[model samples]
Target chain A: SQQGEEDPQALSIQEGENATMNCSYKTSINNLQWYRQNSGRGLVHLILIRSNEREKHSGRLRVTLDTSKKSSSLLITASRAADTASYFCASTLNYGGSQGNLIFGKGTKLSVKP
Target chain B: GAGVSQSPSNKVTEKGKDVELRCDPISGHTALYWYRQSLGQGLEFLIYFQGNSAPDKSGLPSDRFSAERTGGSVSTLTIQRTQQEDSAVYLCASSLGPSGVGTQYFGPGTRLTVL
Candidate 1:
């Protein structure tokens, strides 16, 4: 059961353009985090937004969370070829007592053409 | 300062054979997790270990899949009677605390191929 479902299964844009990816999940969540994977290997943590927080920013990455809608979005500004990779959104349930496994979305394949 | 590490970057075994994969988490981290990713698919949660407490094995696909974390630092995932469908990338991650409270660092992952 995938908790987070990312929209726009794939996207393509120019290097200087901006790319936006959206994730929608069911049920309440404690927090939502985004990760980036290159070459289908290890994933790198990008940013995380807690249920109490509405928005957060790290470098060129901006993340927003809307509990009411159970959705989150990731915006990458000035996209570069280096940013071309698969992006995934994961969410942790709000349950108690150490049940902290993350349910991940299928991911969005972003292609930044230079 | 070292990140999570997994052994045998890649593994290839015949069907019905048993295989073992290892994960060495960062020093002092208390939480470890295992995930499986098929081709062009999202990761599937396998298991989780937090300190000395019992592991959360609810996500394991079958009885053939089992894992253990020794001394709260190193862990191993074992698969008995491997099937072709079991071939996928096995990723290990560790965090300072539970995923709800901390970010998890991932390993390079082992590419397992069951022929």
Candidate 2:
């Protein structure tokens, strides 16, 4: 499968603590994106990091891409109780002639306690 | 100013029945996509439509699943002879241009239960 796999299927942390999730993919990708889903509802785009970019930050979120290792990580600093959600890493790879069809990871379920 | 919207937020149907899910993408957005999310699972790509070009239906699981975009705006996904395994949340997303570099805005999704 071309889908990526996220480490630590579940993580629990206290409020104000930082949560880090790792993702490893099997193929070369154009970009990797992080998304947060509350319960089973729709997903909210968190951040995107291109292959050429080493790292990017958005607010309290940080994303890093290591193309040589085919791995990526998402770090959420000062996580709050509201940050509890299922986080997924999606990658876009060029297969045949199609581009940008996102293949998602199984996701990491994070719970932040207040 | 509005986001993607889906109808019949929840539906319960008997097996072997046909069902249709609707999605209204953000106005002016040219790229639309459909996905399925099973419980505790990742998003499964279903199909994609880019303006008037042919849709990429490579991710469709079977012939019983099909979708169509109307006037390059709204889209509908129809499932024929639905099976119990077909139960899932049908999600729709749209972006300003090509999804290769754009962020996709998703709808709340339509929850289908095949009993």
**Candidate 2 second chain TM:** 0.94
lDDT of 1 by residue, B4-71 (tens): 99997999999999999999999998989899899756699888888755456778899999899888
**Tens digit per residue, CA lDDT, model 2, B1-115:** 8999998899999999999999999999998888899965557888888984545677889999999988989999999999999999999988887756677778999999999
Native-to-model Cα distance after best TM-score fit, residue B59 in candidate 1, in Å:
1.3
Top of the candidates by TM-score: 1
* Most DockQ-accurate candidate: 1
Candidate 2 residues A78-108, lDDT tens each?
9999999999998888555664668889999
**Candidate 1 residue lDDT tens string, A1-112:** 7899998999999999999999999988988999999998998999989999999999999999999999999999999999999999998898775478788999999999
Q: How close is candidate 2 to the true structure, as a TM-score?
A: 0.95
